[model samples]
Target: MKNNIILSWIEEGVVSIPSFLFSEYKSIGLTDLECMLILQLHAFMEKGNSFPTLEELSNRMTLSLEQCSQTLGSLLTRGYLEILKGHTDQGIYFEKYSLQPLWKKLINHQLLVEKEQTEQQLKLEEGSLFTIFEQEFARPLSPMECETLAMWIDNDHHNPALIKAALQESVMSGKLNFRYIDRILFEWKKNGIQTVDQAKQQGKKFRSHQQKTKVEERKKGGTDTVPFYNWLES
Candidate 1:
């Protein structure tokens, strides 16, 4: 019966995913093992709102005692469970493992720290206004793009002031990403734009050009219309 219960839990769904699980894991990633471990925790918790002992789980899963112990240790370290040591009715004491209830709270703290560091790094880069972007938007940035942004901010090659202005323009124009930033930098380099004003001017001109093209396209058939503008504009 004990083995049947364990198997039934596994068969029902080796993992009990909360409704918010996907959105939470989307930022990082979740693994099958992690999911299974959490489900096991849910099952054991049902007995008396306490974690199952290593021996009980081992016997139920038909795993060697050593394997069960190791598995529990790994699950605890990986943030899937938290082990609480306590005493039972008998004089012999034992430990219990259960899912942490305040996981979202913990995640918020980590995110806050990462955001602060990224903003400070951006500020130190080329003294560009692009650092303000950190305050306005929070998106998953790739490691490579993050490094590039850091380098750009550390050096003055990208003109911090112009970068900041361009970033604002991009945000207003519904464009954000390293690719867009790189394109702005390339255009600035070509036009020898040194001040924020130059960048803003170019941005205004680009907007005007876009508006004209959109108006022209409306005059023509919106669909099946192709213009010989730059790749980005197209």
Candidate 2:
């Protein structure tokens, strides 16, 4: 019966795994042997080897049976692997190894990596902003001015693109001052403008558009109004 099972697995063919498991994620935390053990466990599950033997696993690797046990023990202790009881389709309970802990660790590590990348990108953008401002103003920024520029991004949540647009507007208007650029940003904020393109389109609104309708009304004529009545005249 056992030989039949081994033959069945052989007939079932090779199991596929993501290359990243060994190429990238292995070096992050899992040791070489531990990574191999995980892959073997994965293969076992996929190939209907519900419970793979330590002897088989060790034979596949350079590790001895004792070393395999010790490694698995370490993995369990470190919360890298877990045992779970799950139901099959027929409602029969089966014990299986869970890789949930590994998945959770990988997810957290990726999130941290993404966050670090974003921070690095933001730093690069901030440096670029400093250089652009220096070139625009024809002088190095004062400490106080630099602090204000930092506040625009860090505290006010202004993205580099929006600030750059405002700078461009200042240059176009021949008023290359920080105050004018700040006011432009403030106006864009009030108008709920998210992109430079949106703000530019807003500047092209119809003269007879709703936004200008009130001013047009005033320019044309006033609405009808009753004459003021004196209280004592009645």
Candidate 3:
């Protein structure tokens, strides 16, 4: 019976385990062995909904019986897994392990902290206009572009709100760059774009023609790339 139980356990990688066990495993931080055990245990449980035998877990992890038993005991004590009731050819065995809820709560807290850190970093980045300029253009603003942006923000006292909105729109549409902003201003100054709606409409028009030209030129083995600033200069 012991041999049969061991063989059955060998067939399955998991000893009976509870969900809370892995949650605790994550909280205590899983070592390589623990991680391997968790992965194998999960697989075994998935197949039979029973605990894996000592031989089974060892085989799955390529570990010695002693090593697998010791690790399992540690996990059981750490509140990461629990054994339920079981019977086998060898005799009766404890059930698979289970996790406790406290571990789940802790893991959730850690995830929340990570998410907040990311959001805070983004907010700090968004605080500065220069950072936005650098990211959008992939290169620093040219002397002329810098001068225009500075004048627009500092001297003309242009609506900071509108500038920010336009900047965001440009970046999202992949049309962001000093030349793009300059073009928008040039047109706006010429009665071409006066509001966000007009700016969006202009972007759509540019995209339509840009796509059309690209497809046509590609068919002819030619490129239809144009420098946004060069068009204005011409």
Best by lDDT: 2
RMSD for each of the candidates: 14.7, 9.8, 12.9
Tens-digit lDDT track of model 1 for 114-185 = 899987885566443434655545754557866776676566467666767666766675666666766777
Please write out the lDDT profile of model 3 over residues 1-234, one tens digit for every residue. 999999988875645555545555555566767867866877776776456789988877778999899988887776667766776788966565654433564577678778999877645544466656766767876788777777766675444445655676556556666666655565554664556677667656766776777788889999775422222432
* Model 3, backbone clash pairs (residues 3+ apart or across chains), number: 26
Residue 183 error, candidate 1, Å: 0.9
The candidate that wins on TM-score is 2
**Residue 186, candidate 3: how far off, in angstroms?**
33
Ranking by lDDT: 2, 3, 1
TM-scores of all candidate predictions against the true structure: 0.38, 0.74, 0.36
What's model 1's lDDT at 52? 69
What would the TM-score be for candidate 3 when compared with the true structure? 0.36
Candidate 2 minimal-lDDT segment of 10 residues: 225-234
